[model samples]
Target: MEMSEIQAARLLLGGDGRAGQAASRQVGQESASVRYGEVKSVDAEAGTMTVLLDGQSQEITLTDSTASTRLKAGDRVKIVKQGQSWVIDLAGGISRALDTAVSEANARMGAHDETMAQQQAAIEAAQAELAGMDRKISDAVDTAISQLETPDGGNHIYAGADEPTPPKDGLKAGDLWYQTNASGQIAAVKVWNGTVWNGYDMVANSILVAGSVGSTLIADGAVTTAKITAKAITADQIAANTITGAEIRADSVDVNEIASGDIYCKRLTATDGAGYTEMTGNKLEMLDSGSRSLVAIWVEGGVCYINANLAEKISIGTNSGSVLNISNGGFIFSSMMPGFRVNGVSAVESFAIAPGSATESFSANVPYSPHKTSYAVVYYRCTYTDTAGSVKFPITEGGSANVVLKELTAFEAADESIALGCAENITVALGNSPNKTFAITRGNPYRFAIKPSGNSVNANPGSQFEITQVTLCGQ
Candidate 1:
């Protein structure tokens, strides 16, 4: 049967339900009885309950008590019969006492969770520190490897036909023993002995220049004749002033090898037809095709001779436009060309001409000197106007008799130098003369004649004229 609050409270409070009280229970079969059973149903109004006892349902009355505890179906209890009163031992009554222990266990579990979170954060920080250490170690290893690379940053074998420029300042121990050229052949091995490269130098003269290939470095006389090829050493490969007369071996210089450039030796003999040059006992000669001397310098005469065609002109001085030019003019100057005056003055004041068919003339002596020049110039100032032709000079001069003139057709015009029309204060120059040259003397007179035009009429002693500055100018 279901236990009531009064019975449960009594069982829990040990009200006639303890083993001590069981001593007071009657031991006889009909005196008192006790049984263990599960309640199947309860009826609160009837104060009765149905319980399973020994696998059978039994109806039992619930006893009331001052305790307020209650029980329902499914309650496990031990029922005790003492005369007419009943006592119950309830299982629910024991479970109520364990609540405090369960609460304490829950609080401990929460504290453990908080400790785990703190440990996790600390582990992450340790991992970050380890990563930074890894980077530092990696940097240290890289620096060590770089130091192990070379004395300089790079001291490997050099390449290319040109030379190499090794670093000047670097670690001092390791030296560059040799370097290769652009042809991939190892040239003269230069050993850099911590301080300098051992070799022959020209500019510095103590150590090798950066142009370190194709030169000797071991010592003097180290290079044998077998190392040299025929005509291998040209002029450009030798440094200036380094190869002197004392070091030169006899007949070592092949004249054919000097294709161009001047060679200043005491004597040089070249082969025939090879831009020939030879120094003999008396003269130094330069040849053209082979035997013909283009130029020669003779020690006996102390004169430099030029043998060429007459068309060649000798030029002197080096300036832009101003220079002494010696050309083959038809009128050659012997010593000097002094000036000559027509009438001992620069001008002839008055000149007169006669009437038609009769000509007035002027004449002067040559003074037995060079009285004519290469140029012909004439000028006149007019004081008269007449139909007479201009005063004219003979085209050919200088003879005791009639002057020898070439064919008349050689001159197509009366005078190409002067204009036909006359004007006051006019001047004319025959600077562009013909190629023919002439001599001048008193034998042939100037005449200075003027003839009137054909079919023209004129007055007597007509139109007296003025001739000013009739000079044969020098070219």
Candidate 2:
């Protein structure tokens, strides 16, 4: 027999015996009961409400509970809805349910907003961290590129400084260096002098580059004018005479005491045989003056050489004995000569044999010998060393440095191998006249003698010959 507040309101408001009717009508109907009235008086201590209706005021008893709403004398409110009954408004069960639902909804909204805010903050933090890492990685890559870009040229020392040389293939602010990578790439290059890292750094090592052919270490485009020693010159590096970035000007260069234009400057001080010879050019200002007699001549391609007033021809191979024997008539004359003989001051010199002498030609031809063929010979004694040697001048196996004399006694006619041979000693003999006295010795100057074997009438036409001087290491 528990009654809801709506039932109680029905009992209080519906006529005393009309409860059953109100309840029956409200069973399936969605409705509420309300009354219009004015508050006449309120008693705080008694917790009661006195409302006026139709000029009459009635005192109402309030529930003894803290959750109930208190009304003042002039305030107005509605009671809870009841079963088909009209009643005055006041705080009741309906008000409590609404209050609870509104409070729960507000708490849930606050919690949801806080979670969303936290998630947004986390996303922003992650983005900032990623940006910082990107910056660090970029900086690291830039540093690596700079380190790799450093040059690897040979080292150059300053005038008066005591700093240790930089790594051969590493970065250097001031020093001379030339180094390459495994692929023959120019990895690092540096040259340091007294003041700055420019101009005075382009001094060549030995008038030649130390890299292999097609290596690109000292190719044509690698050198420029700013790296030359002379600061006032219009152009410093000659691309045509390309070395490395350290190429010097052709006009201002000297190699082994021989100037660029084959002009003799002084006695060459080298680890091999050294001497000087004057060469007159048939064409004035030829690319090669043919004077220095060094293998590395600065001659342009497709140039012609005309030896005017030259007599006798001497042509020989690079691999053969030195005895160039020419026999006919009565004796055998050999062209095997010595090491150092003054070119113009030798008793035996090469000259074109004049025609007409048949039975008695000058270097007497042995009768019924090896035909009337002409011959030119050079004596050679090879010595090799294996100690401290240069690439161009390699050491031999004896551990006592020496030279290689590829013997070429007979002259070739055309397109012959143009390489030279080195010689330190030579021996000769003439099987002819009863008093054939030809002396041979070392250290004494000598030059190859060019002579024809057959009679002057039927000599080898165009008796051309070549005699290469073998320069020894530590000579």
Candidate 3:
């Protein structure tokens, strides 16, 4: 058994039981010694080395078999204590220390290489990603260039700038180009028409040359009246019947423009024998030189006829007889009037009235004056009930029963007292029964009245009467 140096030293210094036992068990044994330190300095001739041990300086002697000559400052060495002296251990000394250090250095170098390899791989991946990004950027730039530049047709698609000059080569038909002229000025744009280049003038205020007016060049409503010369539109310029009545402005067409035979009328005079002949010319002259009268002239049978009076009688329709005539005053018809015309002042009394049990009279106020000589006719229509035994009669003042003829002067007369009678000169009848209408010569009363016969009539009190119409007329 051998005692380690630490145990022997502890026992020699009066150590505890564990160290004392270790020394006692190997009292005769040699002490095993080993120490490790970095060599601080070395003396080959003296076979001694100054070493740093546990942060303290120590001098150790090398044995005859030790390689102390190979030791240098900063070298790590393992030493053993022998007989109160320290010496490098040959079995596990600087060689073993160098070997352990080499192994550790190799491991660190291996770790550093792995880290470098990882970094290299990361850089390569980043480069590849950057390459892809560059390719995308290049593609985007190419696409942008394609959009901005002209196409194969060599036409400049962009506007509001100077046109491209000389154009791109290999241009097809309809390719447009622009270039400086001989005067070194930008010339008109030219279009390639396969065989030749045709200049297209886009200058403002340029006049359209002859044969240049095409349908595509003219917009609707582009041609206005101001653009046309006076009388430039002739009869041939207008399509047949295209000008409707509404399109013709009022008084725009002169009389000279109207054809004479186009004025068709059934009559032109008031007299039956006097009528217009057929118009022969295309012109009608209406001239009034003097202030006396206005005249209308027409052409018939190559003869011009003039008429100053348009109101003469004329035959119309298939009758060849005078059906209508117009005088200076008005119109007259030989037969019945064409339409009912209001003759004179008229009034309507359309109110319901209840007559008394006794005979009573009803009259309409006349607003018109009587004719001095000629007879004025009064027209009236009334509705009333005639009792079974009652006798009703229309009458005027100052007339006898059923036989009076002269006109009455009184405006109002009693019904029962003055039993006036119908005028003999005037015709009276119970037209349409219970509704009577009659005409009488006008007199002073200027009002019409209806009365029941006082002597023989027994009027019904509940009988209702109404005067619907009254009119007066005179020649």
In model 1, the Cα lDDT at residue 157 comes to 34
TM-score of each: 0.20, 0.19, 0.25
Error of 2 at 212 (Å): 54
Per-residue lDDT tens digits for candidate 2, residues 221-340, read 454233446555565433345455534445335444433544344333334334333334433221223343322222346764433223233333335543332212211123433322
The whole-model lDDT of each prediction reads 0.41, 0.37, 0.42
* Number of clashing residue pairs, candidate 2: 49
Residue-pair clashes per candidate, as listed? 2, 49, 6
Per-residue lDDT tens digits for candidate 1, residues 1-475, read 4555554433423334334564454444422355555666676666556555533333444553311146678766566665556665454333432454577888898898899999999999999999999999967754453334444555433323344455456524343334446664656655455677554222332343245563534345243232343654655344342343434565454433444365566544455445677788776677665467666766556655544443344444454432333444322111122222333332111122212211122333222123333333333333333322222232223221222211111112464331122222222222113332222221111112233332222343222443432333232
Stretches off by above 4 angstroms in model 2 are: 1-20, 26-42, 50-106, 117-125, 128-475
Best by TM-score: 3
RMSD of each: 32.9, 32.8, 31.5
Q: Which candidate, 1 or 2, has the higher lDDT?
A: 1
For candidate 2, the TM-score is: 0.19
The TM-score between candidate 1 and the true structure equals 0.20
Misplaced by over 4 Å in model 1 are 1-241, 249-284, 297-475
Pairs that clash in candidate 1: 5-69, 160-182
